[model samples]
Target: MSTSSGFSFPGRWRATFHQRDLAVFQRVADRHWPGAEPVLPRLSRSANHGLLWFGAAAGMAALGSSARSRRAALRGIASLAVASAAINTVGKGAVRRERPIVDLVPVMRQLKRQPFTTSFPSGHAASAAAFATGVALESKGWGAVVAPVAAAVAASRVYTGVHYPSDVVAGAALGIGAAFALRGVVPTRGQLPPPGRPPADAPALTAGEDLVVVVNRESGSATAAAAVIRDALPLASTVECAPADLPGCLEKAARQGKALGVCGGDGTVNMAAAVAATHGVPLAVFPGGTLNHFAYDLGIETVHDTVTALTSGDAVRVDLGRFRPGPQGPEGADGYFLNAFSLGVYPELVRTRERWAPRIGGWPAGVLAAFEALRGSRPLTAEVQGRERPLWLLFVGNGLFRRVGPAPGRRHNLADGLLDVRAVHGGRTPGLRLLAAAIAGPLTRSPVHAAVRRRKVRLSGLTPGTPYAYDGEVASSGTELTIDKLPEALTVYCPMPA
Candidate 1:
């Protein structure tokens, strides 16, 4: 006892904590809760290698009707991955805590396969907490559902005598920390502002009177979004149709309805905008596509946003880009583009993706198309402003697009009345050139990249059968195409900022 006369206080404190931790572990091992033998042990076993959480993620992605649900599931998985990595590699090695002796614990409650790894912070607890926290951060209802499971998983570690209460607590803390850290880097979707919009005169839909919603069956827009519209606006007519029938349905809806709504991607929105404009009807957009560029830019990310607008009659006038002779009307260009018009390999990529999308899925087909478009495709040679040039990509946006946070492309003002044109000069490497153009955006004029705001651009000298794309729809524009803008040509319903 007299050997170390001047022992540090911190050292003594640590020793005391170790004793308390062991005492708590023994108590947990001695205690028995009825009905725990059948569930928690199996639950912990199922979560041994993050299988349960992955299964939960898959279920959410498959069954959840909204984009937020899908995003929540993805965020949960990401947080879990981060937490698992931290605890297994860093936390375990740092602490070097020995596993609690399970002598006093019942054989029935004990795990079938005892873990061999060091357990200072429980990996299962960490993953559970992280996933639940992540999901909760994105979607509260899902988080509420997942939180109980996470708590159960954490408690099970202590109940089965595999980990001390302190270990489970530490793991959960670390998991929550990891999830918050991720949030710090990327702001929550809810935090993003739905920007300023100049309101336009639009009729308030009384229980969706004279409102017709056209849902594209092939666009992969969420079915739940369509269902929400049907419920929110009981009197609204709903049409879920194939791509071949989309244009016809849209036209019919435009002719009959006082207002037209679309629940699809930018391409589908493009057709709806044209039809609505041609028929003199306001448009409501429900974001259901792979990328709802126009809807996102308009601050309409959910069915709720559109429903609120429809009920309130709040709206805005936005520009639509066009190829020459767009949706023939009083103020239109070849076909209208609500988001972007592109030339070069992008068209081929769209063509390929569309061709295979029915066989495979949308995202997978996109991946396959990207490989085909990049690997086997050649640069497009076209006449731009009377100068012949080889181009990797020629992009024209309906309005000036600006990048904000996670969105690589977004427009602050949809009625800017100018074409956002960007061209990537082609040489040895087309990919690099396109990347450069994308990064430079509307603020550069380098050797391989250039961007400008233009009233119109005359394009020609393309191969006779060369393809081009506008608003996600691919078409052959022969050897000539005129890129132009029709500013404030379309009126769309969007909720006015509070």
Candidate 2:
């Protein structure tokens, strides 16, 4: 038997199941309440162009304002994109099923722009499931809020006489699969390892015997974090320092300890790492900041992980980025960065975000600061390899960072002895080009953005006192600057890969 839409049922048990499922859902949809009849159709229509999901993602990015929320928002949108592609190209093409007829639903609830493609798997349901699952994987609180709306959107397809219950179910499964498949590429919170025997290669150390830990009190959750570290390594000497005193304290501690430990943000870690490097001591990093990017990359998520690594003597050698001012620049000045250094409006953006991060949080503050920087930023002229060029941004990473989706900022091989250098070329409308590059992501290749790998790079032709930032700390630079790699310069504790 075939429906009026020319959807012929195969002589198979699966076909019979699908037919029964559609009939049951059709009957239920026909008796929908008047309130829902009008409202559900409108809601389904609102989701027609993916506007509903996109708006939800934007809202998440704006309101949550943390690394986790931002990641959730990006992952949710990415999942929707993948789910839509799979449902439209593979799921729908594999079957010749047709959409449900309008007669199955109230006339007021029928969607005007009904999908014309085969409907064995509903695209709307797939996108909704994928987005919700992806978001929940990153942040349960936001995912909880999005769950009901995703469910409603999926059910709306059946209510508006566009998809059968079976079609929605298949699409949802496809979407969930897409989300799971993309997990390796997405940045999510690291899971804590179960307590067990330490790896044989772990470094053996007496608890707190020769360890000196410097904690930044200004960092978020510093007090609690310090207490956790103290409990885990009772003999370790813990020093609490104000933000201003962190560098000096770290240097002092580095001189006095067998192993130096740091519990703070990227900036604090950068300083402590320098001190440890200068003193030729291994370092232990604990995540005690708003966004512990370096520590996360190193697989150190908690104080327990640090304690385990310390006791086991598990450590890894990593590279450091060293920046030096030219002869025309500051006198006798050089510094190290573990993550990256940027010369462009990025410094300004960082300063602006720091001013507002306290009130609104990191991600939202970054969003606002980015808009302000893009709107008012001017092109900077620099001499790269002795060629004068107009540039918007110059980024130098200590090592090759992982390209996760559209962002390239996380490094997997910290010991790689190369600098990851990327630049944004100034064009007729450099600001607008920068915005386009941001939206297009790191995957899209254009003349506006260029990247390379090298051991060293030198830039000149900058105005005196131009600002540059390294590992989230912004400072003034001389007329000329040089960046080079310090391969395997630092030893740091990290968990063994499973």
Candidate 3:
């Protein structure tokens, strides 16, 4: 399953040897530093996701009964090989930066017998990304989903002393480029159709004349939000409903001729914003979620104070998250996510946190939820924008941290067009790092942490039943996942501070 200085081990010994090597690594850690402790390697912690993806693909390959399917699988493998060579061999070598570990300890030899390769872009990361890309091209559904795993794996290499975080990033970029370039050469036998264009006969609205509010009862926002809505805009009509009913509500309101106001979680807001955009209406949001990431991004932290300004909130154009689920079975079930659509630890945390919310209320729930997640954590394959690599954790945002809030002092501006991504190579300490990052003051930024900001995120193969939630709602329960940003789509109640 793995090689130790060029000697292949039996599959059964892989696990045992891995443990032994890890033990050796720890001992090495101790020998190198007697009193002080070396920070935990994030890469090692996230490796399981890579192994999981490999197994899943191999299993899928095994299920091929027809010669055509077998041939397709073989071609996919070949594509992966080509991609690996391109990203890892060509791209990484071209970016010849030294690994952070080598920079830190130049005397230390690579743990394993690797080539005398340059370390600017991580080769392992590049290879994993290329492989994920190749897989995505062949089997869009699972392949697209597994891109996250590739990212996770790539990230782990950096965290584990094999490369620099930047190296992983470059490798991912290379992998994605290779995957896209190779798409013409690969066969996607089970590709899914795209989410079609919005129906031609959608709603219409006059921005200043009237307002329509679309709310999801499932968002579980505070009862106070409704009152805030009623007082905020007397002309704004409320349509407390689900996503499916959003378009209808918009259409009905358009007939009545109203603009829009959306007060709920990101999903609810996303639906409302979409309808508002379709109908040419200015939109307003009331902060309602536990995190209220969107609200924070928009610099509208308090709902009550900003209501009046929301009526005249700046109208800005933004992008949207789009997906055409790969060819797996049927057509026309493509979906999109507002805020984030994550796999691996993120979805698991959402599910676990929701289940425990009733028993452990408030911040306590978050604490318990994180504990549960850590107890059963694993690596994930992921692709962002187009970079292929495995990662332990990934968060994609509508805009970069700097862009989402007022950059002056502590505030961030939300209108800029970029996605903020964060991931940690597998490690024990990164958990603490994450906690610290979460609790840190507004002005603080953590560069030592793992993160990337891009336009899109695609992930797959963390679990057979990957439960992803968007804006805190369970969007789907399958392996494939895609997350894109809807930029400046919602003009929330964001007023310049007094």
Candidate 4:
């Protein structure tokens, strides 16, 4: 029976594999597993349409403290989607094996309503493994917490006599592979390094001496971040203050310390930068707030990141985005933006969110604000550069921001010395127009949205008391405005490549 492939008994080999798989399935069905009797069957049912994993993902996004956790949740869901698509369209049809017979299995272990689909591969097992693997790829701690549950879900497929041992194993392998494939296409944050600019000179403060850190009491994970700062940089002085007092605290610290360190969100970092630039001190950022965009973009996700840079004197000179008439509207007054400045419904959304955040919380406040701000808002009429235009939103970034997936773009080169400007065109439904702009991203030039890059931009014709937002803080726009970049204005501490 030897063929060109050198196979003697392909049919017999397959038969033997099936026999082993059936035997293992029968043993799992026949065994009197403790606690699994009431748990495994229901657990299997919960994962029928991938509801359980979706719920788990939502929980991670809602309850997890930091952006990394939210990213892990998103990655997990994406991986699950890939694995499910593969199972339905390719894997199942490739090998249309029948569901295993439950003749020897206990009645209680059997599913109430058996799956009618062909059962070559267990979709539940694939989804479980994929979600867990994707989450672990982003965050190891959350992965460890999820691995046991994913394994249990896979095992339940066999224990309940629906899938053969081989089916579950193959499904899990496919799921893990799907997660890695997704990562390959959309690289993780760790995969990309911060922008490099030939590393500027800074004082290597061993033990973080002469560094003063100001931590906002209301920032997310403030307590834990302060503890880490204390433990990692014991010699660094820390000032804990309310959100209202951050400006003064940061200014005083910038004047007193060799380097000013800040632990808060983008708004806090913006204030810190203004003071740091004025005082000519390097800045160390600890990401201790919700959506710490500035710190994350700078490659400083935690206290350890800043500590490493501090000990090594590794720093970079980054561009600062600035606008005229500052917060004061006085002559020669100006303000700086570390992340972005925006006009239109977005600033209104920020204003609403801030007003209600203390009452309901950040995430809920944002959702409420989105609805409240966009409910009946009309397009803002403004003069751009030298022309009049009606726009729903005009976004200005410190540097060119590249869209990662769909929205909230990231900057790879922070010192590119250009303003990333995106304007959503005025339309009947501003909400839809804004969404289209987000999806259309930085390259789009449509009736709904447009994007451009420049060294500076001038805007005018704003109605009196028209509000604008920069780095999550809202302010009234002056009659005329100038937005530009200060190239390499602020020295920031960041990790040097190993």
Candidate 5:
């Protein structure tokens, strides 16, 4: 065999390998089973311009109907984009190998729009590997479903006589590498560190002096939780209040107690956090809500845990999210959230979920609400950072939320002095985009959504009566809204590390 480039030992070996690779391709293509003829041609056509993979991602997001599935689908799509770029631009450009001639391939199996680029690397193979790897990193189940299809797409490239076997192998490696490279650049849900230990200055709970516990009876688990708290801390004063009376009750308790304990869901805890912050008093949290997201993040899971922490004097100082009314709003109107503040379709989804949660259960209700929100909601137009844009949703968390799989719900540090801000950019078909995003996962590569860590965020250009949600409680906001982080704003009791 003769070398096109200057003769070298490695070049000689590569040329020999290419000869063997072509020989193997000839054998495989010439002896193809008749059964594969019908399937391979259609598969090759279906994958044209990557419409098949895009459709798969979108379908997964819509059918999976959960945050995790949506994220996985999005990650897969992003990986495909990266892989395609690398293979088409860098891999193919680096080598000028010609594609196999039509004589070498059976006439019946040839593609109509044969790729014109150098055949040293196959874009289809690269995209297939990258998408499969990316989805697997986000969700194993979704990855499993995608793997066979990806493999089929890669194999179809060779079966259709568009790429040599060696070219497909090289493309697969490039694609996998692209996926990993992209993963490093953009942190995924699994990349975030776990929640940090409690702050050193956190106050310790003491035995039996001016401890007031307020419980919201309206919470799903409040009645049972209140009973447990009463049994656990007999000396502490306990007050049961309706949802409407919670704020006033919390204020009165904050003034009377050296420490305040709240037993309810995120919304109830949010109210108590505001009162606790104002009074400069330590707070104790008992897991009494349906989801108990705040308490779980705080590492306090049960009444037993709260009692133990109170008796042992274990606690931590954490941040609070403060929301102030914007320029066109009422004076002195502000609020605080221990978890997050949400705008756009999320508030409506929450309300819809609440109505069905008791009957269908939380997960099912959430899925149903997601579909409803996607079907019925319109994008909101808001001014963010001085630019007016259409938005589907805006979420601001008290601290940086760690991405776990497809969801950015968990936090690594409660006192990070930063806000976890996320927003979905509105498009011509906002609902369709949202559905596609949910099926594919975060769509960060596309202009569909964005996530960032910041100290503050401002939004304006809202219709006078715009609705928003904070810690699961819905409320109306003015034309503008400002969310700021309050670092180390409140102290709360949590179980000591083992």
Candidate 6:
């Protein structure tokens, strides 16, 4: 049956699970619940929370009572109401699906109050997200809570068997679209203004250079980054390719001699850079990676905030790290790194965490990776000339690890003639101590993790293998690894020091 005609509750639920893995989500949501019946009630309570929130927001606006304040408040409310109605009505009517309880395995629930119609898309979930997002646009602090609450509300509909997973997802999109459309409801303060002129000196897109955006749709960070780039480069064609397609896209671009802008995580960046370098094209780095060590090294603050700077920033040369594996009965083995090259605990942590990054975000993945590394092994034998005996992990940065920001009197000197090198070989307890120290502040006085400036290095036993990373990509191999810096190889855009 067509989703528009509405399938049996069980059939629709099953289809949604098959198509979008709603069943998998149900398990994820269960982790945060007490297994209460009529999950919609719990969700409805969150919508009510929005109502109270709006009342407070309105009250605050009234206290000030300027034309600006009143206009902003009204716009915010209207955006909320319109988004809510669309999520609850138009979207549901268009894509009719049934609630799980209506046909699926029945969960005993005391039906205190039934929702007022067929349940294809979830009105509660839609309205909650709409209201929450509208509020968040006005106040980020409030949005932090509202966004989570909205997510919970959507999940609750599934738990209560009032809406299929597809319904909630569609409802969310509908509500967000409505909010975006209603953005012009207020004049200037509450609503965004029209785009101003670009910098008078902003360079035109070079002729014959088509724009290609490689995205790992699964990466949440990449989604936002892609949006920003598209908005900034309105005249350029936006091609959204999957992670696997990245190499192909780069190869195609290089064949055509076009400049490609990659909008994804570190792995994506590294892949794009490698392709660009091989083709000898100027590659622009947009920091969408979780750690963004390269971006940090290049001195960009936030992905969204860097558009103007990126569009108008200067292009300068920077070093690249290359790894050449020694002969282990192999004829050809050479890899390039853009950021840092490391082996030992750090590499193991990256490999362990890279697998889980899609499910949990980068930060959470990093934390988990740290936990796993703690449980796994002690330091391996890392040989470096200037360094002591065996080290846990050895890092060689290409000035891309610590770029300067735009703070007054601050500089992110990419041409500093030095690469940041770090070796981690301390015991588990020492490793944990070092992690804590990093959290505290700069490692100028830390002992467990050693930071050194180096130009070249060689390694033997603790070679590149299982727990190893070049840039953000992880791989397993057995060969003698050589690390060297290539100064001023590629050009990238970045804001000048304040």
Best by TM-score: 4
For model 4, what is the C-alpha lDDT against the true structure? Answer: 0.87
**Ten contiguous residues with the weakest lDDT in model 5:** 1-10
Q: Which tens-of-lDDT digit does each residue in 1-498 have in candidate 4?
A: 111212123677776777777777767877789999999999999998889999999999887766778989999999999999999999888877777776667898889899887776889999999999999999998999889999999999988888888888989999999999998888877776556555678899999899999999888777678888999999999999999899889988998889999988788888999999888999998888888888878777677888999999999989999999798789889999999999999998998888999999998999999998789688899999989999989999888787565556568888999998999988789888888888887856998888989899999898978899999989897788899988999999999766
TM-score of 5: 0.59
- Which lDDT values do the candidates have, in the order given? 0.82, 0.80, 0.52, 0.87, 0.79, 0.57
**Which regions in candidate 3 have their CA more than 4 angstroms from the true location?**
1-209, 215-222, 241-256, 302-306, 310-314, 322-338, 382-390, 402-411, 427-449, 458-464, 477-483, 486-493, 496-498
Going through the candidates in order, what is the number of backbone clashes in each?
7, 6, 50, 0, 8, 8
Deviation in Å, model 3, residue 358 alpha carbon: 3.3
Worst 10 residues of 2 by lDDT: 193-202
Give RMSD to native, each candidate.
4.2, 6.6, 22.2, 4.2, 11.0, 18.0
Tens digits of per-residue lDDT, candidate 1, 1-498, equal 111212123576767776787777777777767778799998999898899999999999877756678879988998998898898779888776677776657888888789987777889899999999999998999999999999999999988888877889999999999999888766566665555466789999977999889998767655767877888889999899887899899999988888998988888888899898888789989888887878877878688889899898999998877687443322434587888888888999999998998899888999999889878877888899999999888888877776633435457688877888888888887777777776766857999998889989999887876777887877676667787877788899998766
Q: Give the Å shift of residue 425 in candidate 4.
A: 1.7
lDDT preference between candidates 4 and 6, better one: 4
Q: Each model's TM-score?
A: 0.86, 0.72, 0.47, 0.91, 0.59, 0.52
For residues 81-187, what per-residue lDDT tens digits would candidate 3 score against the true structure? 56566755466445444333332322332343333566655556655676676665555555656676666666446434565455567667776666666655432
Better of 2 and 6 by TM-score: 2
lDDT of prediction 6: 0.57
User: Model 2: per-residue lDDT, tens digit, 1-498?
Assistant: 335433565567666776698677768675746567767778787777688999999999767634677778988998889888887778777788867666767677777776787878888888899999999988898999999988888988888888888888888898888888778666465432322222233245668788989999988666779998888899999999999899789989988888899988899998998888888888889888877878877777677888888887888888888989621245666688988899888999999999999899888999999989878888789998799988889888877766565555456677778887878888777677776666554334577887778799988888988888888988887788889978788888777776
Q: Between 3 and 6, whose lDDT is larger?
A: 6
- What local lDDT score does residue 432 receive in model 4, on the 0 to 100 scale? 87
Better of 3 and 5 by lDDT: 5
Q: After superposition, how far is residue 256 of candidate 6 from its true place, in Å?
A: 2.9
In angstroms, give how far residue 242 of model 3 lies from its true place: 7.1
| TM-score: model 3 vs. ground truth | 0.47
| Candidate 6: stretches off by over 4 Å | 1-209, 301-313, 326-333, 359-362, 386-388, 400-411, 436-449, 463-466
